[model samples]
Target: MFKAYRFVFIAIIACFALTQCTSVPKRTQTPQERPDVQQQTLDLEDAKSSADWLEEAWQAPNDIAKNSALVQAALTLQDEKEWQKSAAILARLDKNQLTNDANRYFRLAKGRWYAHNQQWPQVYKTLEGLPEQFTQKEYKRLTLELLAFAAGERHQYWQALAWQVEAQRYSDEPSPNALWQTASQVTQSQLPAERPRDLVLAGWWRLIDNHHQAMTSPSAFSALLDNWQNSFPNHPARERVNSWVSSDSQSNEVDKSTNTIIAVLLPLSGQYEAQGLAVRDGIIAKVSETKSYELVFIDTHQLSFEEQQSKLEELKPAGVIGPLLKGSVTEWVRQTSLNTPQVFLNQIDADTSEATANSHSIFFALNPETEAEQASEFMSSASSRTKRPLVLAANTPGSQRMVERYKESWSGINEPSVSLFSQRDDMKSAVEASLGLVGSKERIRAVKIAAGKIIVDEQERSRRDISGIYLPGNLQQVRLLKPFIDVSISPFAERIPVYGTSSAHELTNQLGDNDLNGLIFSETPWLVQNGGQNVLLNQWLDARSGWELSQARLAAMGYDSVDLLQRLPIMQRMPGTHWKGLSGVLSVENQVVNRQLQWAAFKNGSITVLEEQPNAGKNNR
Candidate 1:
């Protein structure tokens, strides 16, 4: 209903502005010799005075500047904050007669008045005209500043920043450095050592902004809050974070030892039922051999918050996984205590205070931040050996973030690395440019010869030193890049080893036999065999009747997640060490989960293990 009202309000404003007006004429100077120039000048002054008088009169509209007076006179009533009278007068204005500058000034004035009244939509509408008609720097600066303030009031920080930056760029006046210094000093002033909700909110806001800037992960932000809690133990936010951490720790212990009741809370009867079933199967298969587990399923389809709470209370499971939709998670978190450990299949909305409070209890299914960190660590280590690590990424937003993370991680290690970029349309050219073979027939001929003398010579030169290439793109995009790699090392495919992520699993399917030969990179445990001795896991895989792709990895993660529960203390102590799990080696540090990536090279149309050791290096290239 609120959404509908907002739409209706927008439509009404659109109609009022667009239908009641015609374009104003461009401003032009009136000649002194023109006919009726004297009369026109006198009338203009009279109009201006009347407008000002009406504005003043509107302060007490009942006493003066009544409806029967001139339209300009009625508009003057607005100066007294008589908005209704001002609107009526503005409706009667001859837009065609008003000079462009006057029209703009009037609109800006109206916008400021609306903003002052907290009429955000109206303010937005009125300010829209000022941009097109006003050229004065002062007016532009004022309008932008006011608009930015209005946007900030509306909690539209990004939009506010855009206008604020524009205003600052145009304003020629010197900055108020003294005022800023005074404010900074005030902010730094010591206060009574009491926890304030406002302070917590401010800290959260700063953390969120930093997260957006790619300065830290969500977990890092949570950890910061955790530290704050330690300082002010009684603070509500602090209590919440502590409770969450405690709950997760408790749940992990329960899942490991006793015949644990693991509840799957998801929209099982509705849209995501199939996915829920898949997850259920994965969990079931993982715990089939263990006598210490039980799977309890709860359908979240169309359930209200109260119903969800009741259902969860009734189940009383050791751990809960899901409530897949973000909205459901928010509702559930708001009404329930963080007693049971929870694993969120997706990120909970950061706006929900309850969700943030209970974040310690929840673990995201796919943490891009963790993935980026691990990838960087791996690349850094590989780069140390190769001397030159080349980072390549597509022009997409996701790929760009991945590349930025890689660069950041690389920067932290104080390592030298080169970044390469390829656009979807210019992949061929970008690849050639990166290889430093941009515009030469010799290079072109060398790539074309499959096993010829030229190709062999080029291959030998390339093999003298092995260079690591990091490609952050989808499997399909990576596959397109493979042709370039093949071309670059046509004669020496065996000699030049290529490295990539687990995403390369898909690309492996796309390659021809032996095309990816000598390709080596880290992947999850399920993708490789660490001595190949999981008889039960193999039996389960063979007996399962669905897709055979990466199911093994999921099964391994499930098994590992459950198995690691009992060994949490030991795991936490040596987080960098390898844990022989179904997926690969599992590692955890500071509560951040890291996988001991299994490196493999393409061999005989399958991946062959190259290295199964934990990534021991300090730098992830």
Candidate 2:
């Protein structure tokens, strides 16, 4: 059943895979050994603008002078925080051509440029090796600050805290609030068993541990804060402990008592009735065991504006949820007082919210962007050498939006190669073109014409630089896409990792999903499980022959929505609080719920849930 080309390619690739990559290292040279430009001092104040400096650099008489002018221009741009422009100018100047002072300054500018691009690893790589003594006081300060920021962004919490403390030598005292936020995402296991040698960092570790233990109880948390203040008297966070207590005390203001009445608003009688019903069922299922709260469903589509307003006034519920349509959500916010804490089921843009703007409500849209964002993060954090990836999406509005979101979240320097296929017949060609196999074939044809024989030494190949392939397509498209991708890859090339979005997965027979083998995709935990509520839901759906993956996902969202109403207050107060809901690991920040979904892969025509790994990005291989 295997193709002859695959067998031939496998034999060739196996040999190549065993061959280790070798690099020719270049000898390092110091600035003093390269250039003697001490006599030619450059004055940055002489230039009015970066453009003036760039023009001056272009007209300089010597390489040293030209490099000096370029450094000044880059510095000017850095001071202005124009990172992209500064990076472009820095790219033009050779480091070897500059004096020691200019070279040191160039390193700082380059570090800032990498930081601006959100390339945290590159930022550390560029700046971590720099000398202790910088050319200017502000330069040293900025370097430390950038290192701290880069470390924090990379989730190197301890390093970030250390760098921040170091930066305080030149700047104001390091921000305890910033450090607290940095530690929010870190778990207890991440904390060292042995206390950090640095007293300041140790105090921070203790504070995080105490906060995590007592977060569920305001009284316990208040007592712990007092204890933390007494124990760490000279700690930077000691002053902020009282404010945290105040914040925790304020959280108690949100009513947490049982038997509270909550109103639900959803479209139950219109075009989107099915979606509304599924979500409603999920909510109902989640709350069935709990008798503390009363649910009141308001059909937004069935009621007129006046009728809905009157109904809400009569019910006077503790909190409201729904208005699933984007337009309805916008309209509801604009028209109502929104005094009651509400959770809208959809997201609205700033332009849409300008008229109806209310900050009290939370938006919990099942956005495709969330899946795309997580996928991007997964690929960026993965150990694969693929800096350049091919992103394949269908010629559809949803797929286009997802592709755009993925691009926005991508961390690499090179933009992903995107291939949009409109027709089923064109999918193979699109994949081949994106992976540069077409060019490989063209080269093979050229070789055959010149040699006047089929050359055994030369082989058709996929681009070696492609680290991976990301297919953000629907179930059918992804099924087709995986095979095309498998065939397009060259035998001499390393096996490229393939990733997909939730749309690529469905509950189907193992044989039906054979094409999806080796494809890793993101999906809700509810669909991947075999027991508990999933089992019950499966049995019920199977009895009625009404199981649909998309509807089940909607149901999971509804279930999480109900759970979130109770957890939202706790999450808002505790920054990194996470609730394990069927939809995902739900967390909230700035009134928006974020879902960290589970990753699953097809193995031998069956789906297997990937165990979450530490910094491993899901055992992607």
Candidate 3:
């Protein structure tokens, strides 16, 4: 009986040992057995929950030193499109230790991030770095898909189509087919009816059609029109499409004929009649001789807003211009729906939102912002020649606007030392202060006595050191500031330069034969001796009967404006090309005009053109 009890006790001990060895926790597995144990645990946990598997794997002790847990987590985040997090995880993997699968997955995640950011260049960079062995059909498929998307974003429609076509070799997906269809719509003249929903495609089609009409490419345009008609046989937009095609065809033919109506809308008998007539003359002179266009003039004189509207409605002109008074412009814009392009001859009260809104359909002849930019470039060049600049103006609206523009223009270049002087009772003191002589006791004493003559003379002597002066006041006001000018010019009149605007023409009359002898500035054509003789100038002059004076710059502006419409397709690309006229050299791009003003120095009681600067195209001009 004792022997039998011993055998049973031995068997029980064996059973306990077997249970402990077989059911041991994965964490406690022997070093050699750890991988197997962990694998078993991973299988069981994966069967239950991937989330639980990740949690347990992350919690595994250092004995389980593989990066499997981190990699799995990364894959999870990447599957959810959480690209940044996935990239962070894959970055931690030692490249030499990375398996083929891990490398492929890592590249896939990075490519996706780049594609999301529309970084086409970076996408290509990443794809190029993948291992040669990773070039599986799946990788090619994904690469092509992303390549197509990036190409489209970059406006490379042809490349986009090629990529989509290549992608089709690997995947039978409808998305790639749709992308190809859309690309074709953009790059090809003909398009299928069942194209994918793409707003860009529609915009491209419209742009191409408009361009074809503008360039008089009838064959290309007709083919596109026919294709569109056939594609949308029963489409609701058929009427609008037909109308555009027909109108464009007729307009193109008419544009070539002498019967082309060029309408002029100016204030013939209003307060600003003189200025209006100048602009009118400028337009008529150009077209009257050119058989290509017929000139039509409409005077907005003694007409109420409603009457102006009625007249415009009755006279369906091909194009219109002017109505110089700000109030008159507001009324005309409100009443006229001629669908004709109109040009505003002068600056309007920008405070009027309605007039500005009208600019969408009509072109503004001069944009203050554009003017300021040009002025800045001009000032920058001038500033380089003269290190010191003085801005002189009154507290009037025109003066204030000019001052602001001057400041903006000067800000872009090496800023010149600036001093502002007011045209008030304290003008003398302000002038001295601007010259940096007011605070000096000796300088003050010199100008304080002898009818303030000594100081004026001394200040004038010191003022000659200044490089240039920007005078924003009218000629009358400028003459009033002559004493101040004398302070700067008395000693160095030939060396010290003065600059003024079109207003300076009035001041020019006030100056002695040599008073403004060294001054250089801009003026309207009417203010100058050679007011009206260029072929371009005659166009504007002939528009109106009277020789009402205009800013000399107007002639150049008119030519640039008309020339832009004539060369719209290449406008953006033709920046540096010079458009010479009475005003000066003009640089135009994308319908934006930048004037390269010729430097005219006052010499021997007359203005002489000095140097002609190169127009910097769209840059500085």
* Candidate number with greatest lDDT: 2
Candidate 1 residue-wise lDDT, 1-621, digit = tens = 445434533543464466346433222222222111111111122345554443343443342222223343433444344445455456655555555545665676566556545556677766864654556565676777677655654445445544555565556652333112111211111222333345433333332232222221322434554555555554323444465567544644643443377776666677766555545566676677766667777777867667766877776676676665667766666667756556555455454344545433443344344455566666555443435556667776777677777666652233434445546778766766665554444665657685565433333223223346666665666777777866764363333345566666642352222555555555665655542333654566567656443545554555555544434433333322335665555554433345556666566766667654333232334
| lDDT accuracy of residue 293 in candidate 1 | 69
Show model 3 residue runs off by greater than 4 Å. Answer: 1-259, 334-337, 347-360, 364-373, 382-388, 412-425, 441-467, 480-483, 489-495, 506-513, 524-597, 613-621
What C-alpha lDDT do the candidate models reach, one value each?
Answer: 0.51, 0.70, 0.50
Stretches of candidate 2 above 4 Å error? 1-147, 162-207, 214-259, 351-360, 383-387, 453-459, 509-512, 530-534, 543-545, 612-621
Give the candidate number with the greatest TM-score.
2
Candidate 3 lDDT over 1-621, as tens digits, reads 445434433543454345444421122102211111111111112332335434544454531223455555554554455445555555555645656665665565566656554456666666653423445565566666666665555556555655555565666443523542434334223323333454334433443344334334323655666677766555434565576578656655643443356556677676766655555545654565445666666777766667766766666555555555666665665655555556544444444345444432333344434443454546555454324467666766666677777776563333444444544675666666766554554755645774553325333335433545666666667666665666644443344456655555542342223566656656433334342233444454455445423433454454334443343322222232344444444444333344444445456776665456423122341
Q: How well does each candidate superpose onto the true structure, as a TM-score?
A: 0.48, 0.70, 0.50
Give the per-residue Cα lDDT of candidate 2 at 532: 20
What tens digits encode model 2's per-residue C-alpha lDDT throughout 359-382? 456778888888988887777666
List candidate 1 segments past 4 Å from native. 1-259, 267-274, 301-306, 323-335, 345-364, 384-386, 411-425, 439-466, 489-496, 507-513, 530-552, 564-579, 587-592, 612-621
lDDT score for residue 471 of model 2: 87
Q: What ranking of all candidate models by TM-score puts the best one first?
A: 2, 3, 1
Model 2: what TM-score? 0.70
